[model samples]
Target: MHDESTKQPCCNPPWEPPQVIPAQVRRVNNLIFRKINQFHRENNVDNVTPMHDWIMSYLYWHKNDPVYQRDIEREFSITRSTVTNILQLMERKGYIERQSVPQDARLKRLILTEEGVRVHEKTMLSLHQTDEFVAGLLTEEENAELLRLLNKLRKGLE
Candidate 1:
């Protein structure tokens, strides 16, 4: 065995452990989140969190499509109860509404209200800014590769 003083016990590339990939990715995600939260605090923005902003953006992206609670649950990988709670809060905030489907009265589709549209437009800019800030840390090619690898990791999870 190598001497403890001479050998580094910690893992490092090109000998890094498999878990290192996810660990590093998580750290970067947390860093971005902290930055976004810090921006909100610095701007004295309240009544909304990053999650809320993200949901609004998603709704905006699919503004024309009919979405449901289950869809949000799947997209966010959250539980039904959690989605319900969040949707309730958003409804109260006038950000979203549940409309009865023509074919099925029991099925309610999720659609962004006018206020939600406005909020989404506002937050989308901030989201892009945050992404641009992170993208600036790498070359454009590296950024594309990073996204591809991240998507691969996500597919592995699925």
Candidate 2:
């Protein structure tokens, strides 16, 4: 005797709409990427590798140890071809050197050249300055909290 379309609702779900909070971290990351690209473009240093490659290369250089291409691939979750291309470009730019291991000629070890070391140092200094500038507006506790939250997010993703 009842029409399905006219059946009464068991309950009206609480009509709480989802709240939209400002994603400050996303905004900051986008700003940083933009600034880095702009800086590189203005300096005519955009070639040789992408911004991310430069960052990874710098980190490897600072570590001051021979690294395997497989390590880079694993750490960055990048494709083999992409890693090879970046390494080749960096090698051509004198930013890195690739040497075959004695025991296994098929495997290669990557070392940052002196020029790469200098570049890494300068880049790190600039990055530190930028970090200080950004954190200047935040209270110490806020800065710590931000780092903690970021770490938690990163771990969750991993």
lDDT winner among the candidates? 1
Q: Pick the candidate with the highest TM-score.
A: 1
> What lDDT does each candidate get?
0.83, 0.68
Clashing pairs in 2: none
In terms of lDDT, model 2 sits at 0.68
lDDT measured at residue 4 in model 2 versus the true structure, 0 to 100 = 94
In angstroms, the error of model 2 at 139 is 1.6
Misplaced by over 4 Å in model 1 are 1-19, 41-46
> Per-residue lDDT for 1-158 in model 2, tens only?
87999775787544433332235656777787666555555554544234434545544644666578887877777889988988887778887788899999999988877877766655555555557767887999999998998878778877
Q: Over all chains combined, what TM-score does candidate 1 have? A: 0.80
Give the least accurate 10-residue stretch of model 1, judged by summed lDDT: 38-47
TM-scores, each model vs. reference: 0.80, 0.68
TM-score of 2: 0.68
